[model samples]
Target: MDDTFSPSRHGLGHSTNLVGRPSAWMASPGFNDAPVALHIWGVREMNPALFTMLDQAETLAEAGEAFLAYMVAMFGIDPEQRDAAPGSRKRFRSSFLRLIQGWGFDSNGPEGAVLKGWVESRFGILPSFHKEIIPDTQGPVWQAYVAERMQSRFHDNAILVQLDLLFEFCQWAVARFAYPGQSHLTLYRGINAVDRHGILEQQSRRAAVIRLNNLVSFSSDREVADCFGDRIITTRVPLAKVLFFPGLLPSPLLRGEREFLVLGGAFRVSIEDI
Candidate 1:
């Protein structure tokens, strides 16, 4: 959420709804009603000491406004439209924070929480549901696990995109290895492409299996392939997680042509190009 994004450079025009025009790899359906990967419980859940920092003299409405502003500062949601309505900011707080706590199907904090139980039941990681099993050291594997879980969860309801992660890693590789200052990370996926969302079953699934098999092809990773191999890469950082640590990923990892993105399907390290 870096506020440093130049509008002309980043292409975030004066658009309010981001439902249609996401990065090419993302596609429209993914943004429309995609799965919620990681939803923080609340503004209070953001920092343990946040509630203590609030001002008692301020009205709850003003307090909520400030809270959302603080969140906007943290997440860096673009100021696409001016926030001008009287109670709009507070309403943002009530809705966004409330949705964070209530809407996400899974989460990574606290015992007896709604998201925690959902994660447990969905992934079959029961009994120790609240335990922090995703280790910091196992960064790649932890991320892959999350992505796979997201795919499984949204299989019936959402259009998942693993493409952005690949693009990010590719850009990372180019910036890290190609040229230090010549970091060209802008990989644009247009907004016109479309894909199917309806489930493929019966003869269709078999036909899909045959058609996909027929279209399959492979090539060696010569230097040229290594230069732009994001098409083959699939690891990705979740959007929710990326908001917190914007610069943790270096570009070098993305450019490597090996199948390093998916390590045993338990871990993944992918990047979006843009």
Candidate 2:
């Protein structure tokens, strides 16, 4: 596990070395107000050996199978604890599986919090919401627990690693269907918070710098995105920015058409009509 972001970071007075760059050097000089960051780590720096196994797979299904297999192999859960019989929940999922499940229940719930923490640790994109707006990272509100929530709950979780594999697999699948001329996929997200509070900067009437949550759901269908909000925010997401999408997993877990899990950062976006 990467100790760069430990649960005891605040308490232990430890330094957190962010993996992703937040300065928006990728943006042009005029669009520098909004710091755009893609949630990714260098393959060579963290785990070069991991993708060597991916070199053998040819098809999407095969890649998915390989992804699941690699995830299970990497799960460090105790064998006896893992094999324990399911009681009330029908078929009980392992600790790692619950993080994904938790995301379904509510994006502001415990699972969502942990997943956001994982994104922050790995991608350096801080979460913009907790129960409410995380206005300031240095404020008293943030110091209360920080990310100890991730460390305290389910001490035996490999969900972060599982999500990492899931992201890599999604990235691979996105590349498989890459069009010859296209560099980005148009993704839409409907948002309600257009006020002074949530937005990082109100640069213009149509365009503003908004800080999205570390991990967020978006739609490829404009109608679906419109259904969620009074205002629609459309972003031309590069294939690399997509973390996960529907149909990527054979399991019914990610069921839906044109839905996506996108990595978040400060993005200057135009608000479109709903």
Candidate 3:
């Protein structure tokens, strides 16, 4: 008898090797081709209280608190648990405040040194030095210097990772609001960019979806819908993958319309067609 063929050595039961096998759960199931309804709404249409709270927040902490409150109210997150957790909303608020304050002060002082260290660690780049003409003044010159450094820093890979973490927090915060039977939600920032056609598009004219594994696995052709009050827009594509891009709610697009929060759902049709 060959020992290699023995059932005791190997097992009588059948086993499957799932390594490198494509997941059936990840399949699109033709959702991209299905017709989808869309909704376009002003800011006021979706959670007016949240809009009000955001508007009233004067400081970075206040603004972050308002955002967290909005998440709890809309998505049913436990406030105590969320606040106590590492990388909590409070931490994000603190980081945001630090970023702004760091830019306002002289880079040689204690606060400035800590800020520079943070930037170096988080962004993996030593920010280029800008000579300060005035001492300890948060004036236009300082603002310009900081802004220029920040813009350059934004190009770093580590910044993208930080942005992705922020986006993940945003998604986790609002995931409860996802449509029935859906386990994932998309989050994106609106952008204005020149396409291959050489046309300069307006803000909200293009959107860059957050680059998370769950969100990016789906086909780009798939559409999503969002509803705010009486307004709705459907048939949007999850085109570009991004992190830390701004203009999520462009001022020009929301000039006359009321403020509204963006939501995500699966639907059909390209965002450009809407």
Q: Per model, state how many residue pairs clash.
A: 15, 0, 14
Tens digits of lDDT, candidate 2, 75-154: 65333332243232444334545655556556666666777777766665566566665545787545542654455654
Per-residue lDDT of model 1, residues 1-274, tens digit only: 0001111122211232122222222212232124233222232343434344334314433433444454446444333212223223432321122212222222332211322223232222211112222323235634544454443322321111112222232233333333235411211111110111111122331121000100011112333333433322222222321211112222121122221111011112122231
Q: What's model 3's overall lDDT?
A: 0.29
Compose the digit string of candidate 3's lDDT tens values, residues 1-274: 0000111111111122111212221112232233222212222354466556655755444655666555545444444433243323442322322332232233233323334333333323222223432222246744654555455322333433333233333332322221323432333222111121112122354332111111111221222212211212223332211111122211122212222122112222123332
Model 1, residue 41: distance off in Å is: 13
Clashing pairs in 2: none
Stretches of model 1 off by over 4 angstroms after superposition: 1-49, 79-274
Better of 1 and 2 by TM-score: 2
Model 2 bad stretches (over 4 Å):
1-53, 76-96, 138-140, 143-148, 177-182, 200-204
Once fitted onto the true fold, the runs of candidate 3 whose alpha carbons sit more than 4 angstroms away are 1-151, 155-158, 178-274
Best by TM-score: 2
TM-scores for all candidates: the values are 0.19, 0.72, 0.23
Q: How accurate locally is residue 212 in candidate 3, as Cα lDDT from 0 to 100? A: 11
